[model samples]
Target: MATANTAPNPAQDTLALVGRILIAYLFIPAGIGKLMGFGGTVGYITSAGLPMPEVAAAIAIIVELGLGIALLLGFKTRWTAIVMAIFTVATALFFHKYWSAPEAMKMMQQINFNKNIAIAGGLLALAAFGPGRFSIDKR
Candidate 1:
């Protein structure tokens, strides 16, 4: 009988590298867009009735861009993933609260809420598994 090969596969490392890039895609451009239209983002945050819209925007930029870059480069992978996961969930709760959204906007809010949940799932995986062999952490 042939046994299944359980040893680590190098291809998975390559896949992990690609996965990191894919995950980073979710944040890097968003951060840039938010920065590019700082006032607009602040306005949106303000509309959400969140306290300290400006401060929230600033923190969002740091988490989205700074941690995003770290994830892309696989630097401090586990920690970065943890932080990103938490940020994603918080974003969903604060901004994508579909139940509180107006009837006209409910569908969009639901989509964004679900999307953030999915992204958080991926981040959790990255945290548990680390960034694989291609990462700076070299796990």
Candidate 2:
């Protein structure tokens, strides 16, 4: 019978660190952008045809910024990651779908939307597996 004496794999530890960093880094700029209202984020939300655009903008900013901070600090990582994953999906569908974009911009919009979906998938994985021992949860 195999005993539980397996040595820790440094490669996996490194990969986990990379994954944590990648996922965490992606949210930082987005959160900052929403918090600072950079690139006319509020106006863009209004242009996206959502009802009560300002309210939507505020909610988005709060969720993105708040959850992002939680994720960065590794606090409540599972819940934060799940919330971020859902937010990413919704944002991709509502904001990046680009149904009305011109031909030249359609490709870029599609790529951007798909990229968000991929990011959401990564967040979901993190939510399921957690941030490992290096995180606040430490599960």
Candidate 3:
């Protein structure tokens, strides 16, 4: 019987690299925008009625920017993905609450909510798989 080879494959590594880049790319810009507009971020969070809007904004910046950069570098891939997954899901529940949105905006909110959830699912998958050979985790 032939055994399945488990050695790392270049194609898989490239794909993983691409995945990391795509996901983290979304975060980096978002973080930068939030950081650049700190007051606006805090205001938005406050409007969501979350406690400690300032603190929440800071955490968002850290998670999106710091964790994002870590993911891009493939550093602590599993932990990073797990954290990002949690963050993404929480964002959907808190910020993308379609049920609470004005009727005119409900559809957009629903779409954003779904998108966040899907991104979280992807993050969870990344957590389970670990970063590929190309990551700083180095497989």
Candidate 4:
């Protein structure tokens, strides 16, 4: 029988570190922007037909900042990534329903929807694979 290599790979570790950092970069600023524009975020959410827009906006800020920071530090990596994956998908569904967009906005909405899905896929990968040697999770 052939045995699979069950060893640490430096390249894989480095790549995981880079991926985590990049994802964090994407989210942290978004959280900060939402925090700074709380009223706008609430207005946007209301426009999307969601109830309690203020509450939704608050939850989004918390999740984005909390999970984004945790992912940046590689803390509770697996669960954090999983939660992020869920959050990404939910936002994509609620906020970027490109199929319903008016023609002119369809293309942009479609692109945003696809990007959110792709990010969720990446988060799922992080959940499947540990945060790697460079992470606080490793310590």
Q: Count the backbone clashes (under 3 Å) in each candidate.
A: 0, 0, 0, 0
Candidate 1 achieves a global lDDT of 0.90
TM-scores of all candidate predictions against the true structure:
0.91, 0.82, 0.94, 0.94
Q: 1-139, model 3: which lDDT tens digit per residue?
A: 1125675577777888899999999999999999999999999999989999999999999999999999999999999999999999999999898998999999999999999999998888789777888988984
Which ranges in model 1 have alpha carbons more than 4 Å from their true place? 1-7
Instruction: Tell me the tens digit of each residue's lDDT in model 1 across 1-139.
Output: 1125564478777877899999999899999988999999999999989999999999999999999999999999999999999999999999898998899999999999999999999999889877878888985
Model 2 alpha-carbon drift over 4 Å, by segment: 1-14, 98-100
What tens-digit string does per-residue lDDT give for candidate 2 at 1-139? 2125853355654455567677778777776787686448778887888898777777777777777767766678888888888989999999787677888889899999999999898888778766655656654
- Local error of candidate 2 at 82, Å? 1.2
Q: Candidate 3 has what TM-score?
A: 0.94
Q: Candidate 3: which pairs clash?
A: none
On TM-score, who's better, 1 or 3? 3
Task: List the lowest-lDDT window of 10 residues for candidate 3.
Answer: 1-10
What value does the lDDT take at residue 42 in candidate 1? 99
Output the number of the lDDT-best candidate.
Answer: 4
User: Between which residue pairs do clashes occur in model 2?
Assistant: none
How high is the CA lDDT of each candidate model?
A: 0.90, 0.76, 0.92, 0.92
Candidate 4 per-residue lDDT, tens place, 1-139, comes to 1125675588888888999999999999999999999999999999999999999999899879889999988999999999999999999999999999999999999999999999999999999887888999998
